[model samples]
Target: MAEWVPVFRGEELPPGLMRVVTIGDQRILVANVEGTFYAIGAVCTHTEGYLDEGYIEDRTVVCPIHFSRFSLISGEVVEGPAEEPEPTYPVEVRNGIVYVQR
Candidate 1:
């Protein structure tokens, strides 16, 4: 069974920024796109690059190691070097707090 875990305060992550968080044994990459929050696997599928160290362009996140682009919405591989799609988690913001389903 999965439960919603409070990861961070909403104010902690501003627009166009992201951070890596650990919930249980999972390392998740949390991104703030405009005002919406998105959660995905922290590791890049291609080379295990830390996605938090990468940058977001529009709605895609580019890997820092090999520049593989992954969609923030669907976690799909938008560009190559990575054939596998990252796993995405359900994110919700409640009363200025951000939570991720784990």
Candidate 2:
């Protein structure tokens, strides 16, 4: 099992925002959707599109390069150019701190 690592203070990320964080050589995209936190791979599966450069549409993150829409909840492909799912990390909030587990 992977241990959870503190990524950010809960107040740092408000609702409807996305941030890039690095944890022990792993680059992860942390998204805040109405107070719910989700962490996903920063790299797009189809191409080398940087996910952090993409915009969030509702619960999906659109790839900036090819415009692939990836579900934030399941990391599944909502729209294509990408057939693979993005890897999502487990997230939790405690006492105003956000933690992400690989």
Candidate 3:
């Protein structure tokens, strides 16, 4: 089983905000939508845009490079220059902390 790494305190990331956490060699973008947390690969599939620099529109993350939009919840390409979908990570909240599967 993949390990679950603590990424954020539940209160640290409020609704409509995002942060990047590095686990091993992987960079993951963690987003907060309403009160739920979602995680995905931090690099944009299209042009290597750092997704942590992107903005969130609802549950969608807009890529900073070419505006390739990705769904934060599903890691699917919502709109693209990015033909490939990002990898989604399982996220959980326990004892007021947010954990992401690595």
Candidate 4:
């Protein structure tokens, strides 16, 4: 089974905000959508642009490079130049902290 590592506290992330964190060699983007947390791959599939630098619009994360948009909740490539969906990590909330399964 994968281990869940603490990424950030729920209070640290407000709604419509994102934080990029690296656990070991894995880079993940943690987003807060109205007190709910979602974790997704930090790198864009197209050119490895940082998704954290991208804008969040209505639950979709748009890549700054080629304007590829991905669903933050589902990791689906809603629009692309990106042919593959970004990987999503499982998130758990405990004691107002956010942990990600990696």
Candidate 5:
């Protein structure tokens, strides 16, 4: 069964901002693009850098260590040094709260 965990409220993450939260053993990176929310793996596949500490450009999250860019929505490796794509979680806004489907 899939579990939905509430991470934050809709107003907590503004446009072009990223938030990091650890749930159990999973480190989640939540990004706000325009007004939509996207959740992905926090650790960069290149160097284990935190994606939340990196910059947000368009729909891509760049790694702070190696400048590898990953798509926030699809979790694809858009830029290199990181060949593998990160895992992404489905996000849903319900009653003004942001929930991550796991």
Candidate 6:
């Protein structure tokens, strides 16, 4: 029953940036890495830190609370206080817009 939802214009998020978006009740974290877009659960696995408030380093997002690092593309925990990997969603771009499948 899932479908792709348009979240933002592709140009709104530049490389090395992230944003938090709400799609019908689900909160998601979106990132841009060198032009490719990625989507993941918005909350950090360890302490529920808002990932949109996190810092970007290389391809990783560092949680602002406990400094946990997660891969922007895979949502794998790169460095932690977090042992669980974040839930990653499929992302696509079409007609100069970015969409996420939930």
Please identify model 5 stretches exceeding 4 Å from their true place: none
lDDT of 2 by residue, 1-102 (tens): 699999889999889889989988988999999889989888899996889899999999999999999999899999998999999999999899999997
lDDT of each: 0.95, 0.92, 0.93, 0.91, 0.93, 0.91
Clashing pairs in 2: none
Clashing pairs in 3: none
Best TM-score goes to which candidate? 1
Q: Candidate 1 on 1-102: residue-level lDDT in tens?
A: 989999999999999999999998899999999999999999999999999898999999999999999999999999989999999999999999999998
Residues 1-102, candidate 4, lDDT per residue (tens digit)?
A: 799999878898899999898999989999888777889999999999999998898888889899999998999999989999999999999998799999
Candidate with the greatest lDDT versus the true structure: 1
User: lDDT by residue for model 6 over 2-102, one digit each (tens)?
Assistant: 89999899999999888998988888999988898888889999999998898888888899999999988788999988999998999999999899998
lDDT comparing candidate 4 with the true structure: 0.91
Roughly what TM-score does model 3 have, to 2 decimal places?
A: 0.96
Worst 10 residues of 5 by lDDT: 15-24
- Provide TM-scores for the models: 0.98, 0.95, 0.96, 0.96, 0.97, 0.94
* Model 2 bad stretches (over 4 Å): none
Ranking by TM-score: 1, 5, 3, 4, 2, 6
Clashing pairs in 5: none
lDDT of 5 by residue, 21-95 (tens): 887799999999999999999999889999888999989999999999999989999999999999999999999
Off by over 4 Å in 6: none
Candidates 1 and 5 compared: the better one by lDDT is 1
Off by over 4 Å in 1: none
Instruction: Write down the RMSD of all candidates, one decimal each.
Output: 0.5, 0.8, 0.8, 0.8, 0.6, 0.9
Tens-place lDDT per residue, model 3, 44-66, is 99999999898999789999989
Candidate 3: residue 97 Cα off by (Å): 0.7
RMSD of 2: 0.8
